[model samples]
Target: MDNAATTKITENVLKAMLPYLRENYGNASAIYSLGQKSRAAIENSRIKIAENLKVKPSEIYFTSSGSESDNWVIKETLNPREKNHIISSKIEHPAILNSLKSVERFGNETSLISVDEEGFVNLDELSEKIKDNTKLISIMFANNEIGTIEPISEISKIAREKNILFHTDAVQAMGNVKFNLKDIDVDMLSISGHKLGAPKGIGILYIKEGVEISPFINGGEQERGMRASTENIASIVGIAKAIEDAYANMDENINYTSDLRDYTIEKLLNIDGIIFNGPIDNRLPGNINITLKDTKPQTMVQYLDMYDICVSSGSACAAGSINPSHVLRAIGRSEEDSLSTLRLSINHNNTKEECDYVVEKISEGMKKFKNR
Candidate 1:
């Protein structure tokens, strides 16, 4: 239900974090015994996360959130030089787009690749945008709003051939997809903890060996002086546990959620004036974004709240804004179509009953809207 924005933390992750919050509270930079213990815990978490991604622990840099990681990668790659050119897609999360806007204020150049009706970027156009001055290519592995997975491997290959740095905001695709750093070979990648069932306020940036970049924050010698400030030991530990749990059960979880997604889509399709956005098959397992013609998404969300069913129209980060979804617009949706879009992301914890209830409530909501 609330899967698009975030997910409820699992009991295991919570349990792992309790001890650090309660007794093991110590600064990781301190040389005391307690500090050493906390530092060891952080290191272990980094190793586990790196193992999952098939990267060395030294390659992972923990930060405040996925947004911070994305911003850092962009600024670092384009800094200390005059020619500032970045390539990204239009369907990226606002974290990347908005940060790029900030970079542009300093005379940086950017090319936003447009997507097709299914929200997949035009790779041929993407190739054409790359120039000798293009410093970096930052794209999302999956659309947070429509759940369309991008051909990142292909994109990364192209960037490699062009000698351009590549970064992917894998926040939405981390737990849901199988990715190995060795295969992707991107220069940088961003991931968040809360998206995979860990707590918020913690994220990871994987910097491939030999990638030169500047730190976003400066203070103490943490994260090998790449990032500063005392580490969030509890959250980092929980993030590792969350990633380990998610990866271990990924296959079963994907199968279960995909079944729920298919069922939900089938029922919603039976309803009048509803259309599914994004690719039918090449999307995340639990994502189902739909446009309900003749009904406003805000009104639908309010009504669904009465049934204790939570959903979203787009990225939660951009919630409460009246603007139409940029991702939807990138996919060629009209303003009305964009305004009517509703995102119902699912997870392994969601039940078949929940999907049926959502469909029933949506149908009833539509009738009310029609009558009005």
Candidate 2:
């Protein structure tokens, strides 16, 4: 049920990518016919993606991953030596937070606007934090852990009024929630293919036509001298097809998952000491993050895995360190409670029966934990 972390690539996406993997294998930068075929595929994918997002194809820049896209925007846009500030929320992905460290190292300022108990950004605080030196504002379109969809239009309006550059990490929101770049008015945006049923290691950075920023990766001409690297043609084709499929079935998928999600929530809440973590409204359709009182999330995860059910914890596991999730903490969860969070993200492929089995196993685990 951990669709938020990644999704299984659909057959349609796989079929579209197969040609690039087999017959169309060639360097997109080369001059041979085979290479030109790859190039043509890339351009067609770009146009299709642009049409889906309601933006020009020229605005799309492919990157290795969403993290790379986020880093490119933060590191390339704000010159460390310049007296400038960038604003983001406390609940953003590590990609944004870690990149901001470079800004602080150079004596420049960064403002982390706080979020409310439901994980929505405090717009008034964001507005108050902006100063004369504030040059960029990057908030996420939707949070990955809690599934809280932020107010994108309002945030863009705030940035527009101040003439500050606005960016959003839409990695989690790309196929799940549809928004038009022309209407949202964001200067830049980032998305990952893996989150939307394409393979990992492919992402997109959408830059408004007139927006100015330095190149991220430096090498021989590629990505129009903006990002330098040979493209992964197969994954690029996969992402394009994945997005097309997602858009076509968006409403049906939304309705199906929304109903299953509400049903699952009702069933799971029957367990004593269970509590919901994220907002009930303005939330993603297929997400259910919750805390099971007095049970460690890691232990619960293992217990469920034994029954062949997969879920994710709210704790961050990096290197050898395991810490409570910054997301749960930002939303007013205590440290111990934060460690008890379990993220259950369902998709269209999941059925109500699977959710019932998951709930039954979880209920059994909670009982076992309580008895112990």
Candidate 3:
């Protein structure tokens, strides 16, 4: 149920990566035939990924994770000395927010535009915030916790009109949304492999060709010198396979998960005090976040876990934190309501019977907690 947190690597993806991990083990940077084979595999995977994204092969740079990609774009894309202001939404992931905070030391200022009750960015405010010094706008394509897909194309347009660069952390939207960068003017985008059923270590940074940005990591010429460190060949192959699989079955997966999500939401909301969060109809297909009145998120999480039903209070990244979710706060949820929020992210493999079992357990927990 916690598919948003991380997905089980697809069996096909795993199999695709196995040869690279074993018989074909070679340093992609070396000059031997074995190494050349590894290099060829990496380039082939990159081409496949580029084809999936409908972008040129030269624009894609493989990174270690979405956070690194987000950080690279936030910290590297603009010159702090010249155009120093960056615009972003208040409900952005910590990867974007924390990167902005770090760049402040270099004299860059950040404007965090507030979102609406449904987690959509206030475009007027964003337009109003852009000044001569506003060099970049970095907003997420979707909210990981609340599952609200933002107005990405509109944001891209706003950035273009201002002649500023646009970047999106599309980590959560990769497999779930209809994301073809060719259709939008977004300057940069980020995606993580694990979110799409690949291994956790690989990610992609799609830098639109001609978008000028200096390299963040420098050493042993890798990622066309944009990023360093030896390539993880197996994981690269895994990501390509995972993405291919995800797109091939995307329509069916979306329909199945969307139906399961709606079913879960209906049953869960029937509980006396449950309040739905995020955009009801416009959210990510498999996401269901709700506030269970008077009940803490951790309590329900544990209660559900007892029955082998996995879910989350919020992002898996912020798993053990005691603080209220920043996303909920941005949408006007009180600290207490944020604390009581639960996220149930389903997938194609999940079924209505599973949702029913989860609902039964949740109802039992609510009653038990009410008594205590």
Candidate 4:
């Protein structure tokens, strides 16, 4: 049920990556024939990813992780000399919020836009906050905790009219949601391989043509000089294959998972004091975030784990901190109520039996905790 945190690497992705790890193990930057083979493979993977996103290959720049991709766009797009203002939401991942903190250290200004009770960014507030100095606007494609999808196309239109650069942290939305960059006027988007069925340590940052931005990493002239590092060849190949597999099975997977999710939500609602978070409509198909009254999220999570069922209270990045979720707080949840939240993210591979089993454990735990 914790598919949002990460997913098991599919067999096809591993099969595609093995050759790069063993037989084709060569530096992509080198000039030798073996290195050329590695370089060609990397380009092929880039092309495939671009095709999936409906963008040119030049727009895709590989990075170490989704965090780095988010950091790169923020660091590269903000010109401290003139344009100092940035706009984002309060419900963003720490990657965006923490990077904005760094941007503030350099005397740049930022506006943390607020979201509504259902975790949707307040579009009117977002438009009102934009100023002439606002060089960039970064809103995530979806909420990781509550699974509310944002209005990226509408937001992009607003940014375009204002001539501001638009970006989306799409780490959670890439494979689960269907979108094409060519149809949207956004300037940049970020994706993480591990969020789908690929391994960790690989990500993508897509920048539109004619968008002038500085380089985040400076060295070796790699990633078309926008980012500098030796490419993780195996991981890169694996991610492309993972994405390919995802799109190939997108419809079936989404329908199946969404059906299971709806069924789970219906059953879980029967538990006393169970209140669902996020809007019922326009949310991610596989995500179900809810709070149980009179029970702490950590306590329920611990009890469920003992039953060999996995779920999370909030973002995995924010795990281990004994604090209320910032995302839930942004949506007007009380601190104590936020502590009672649990995020159950189903995946395509989960079955009705698994969903029922999870709901049984959750119901049992809620009853056990309430009596105590």
Cα RMSD, each candidate:
1.0, 1.4, 1.0, 1.0
Task: Write model 3 residue lDDT over 197-222, tens digit each, in one string.
Answer: 99998999999999999897999799
Q: On residues 1-372, what C-alpha lDDT tens digit does candidate 4 reach at each position?
A: 999999999999999999999999999999999898889989999999999888999999899889999999998897667648999999999999999998898889999999999988888998999987899999999889999999999999999889999999999898888888988778999999999999999999999999988898889888998888898999999999998888888888888888889999999999898999999988888999999899878888899999889999888999998889999999999998898889999998899999999998988888889734
Clashes of each: 0, 0, 0, 0
List, residue by residue over 244-309, the lDDT tens digit for candidate 1: 998899899999999889989999999998999999978999999999898888888999999999
Where does candidate 3 stray beyond 4 Å?
none
Report model 3's TM-score to 2 decimal places: 0.98
Off by over 4 Å in 1: none
Off by over 4 Å in 4: none
TM-score against native, each model: 0.98, 0.97, 0.98, 0.98
**Residue pairs that clash (backbone atoms under 3 angstroms), model 3:** none
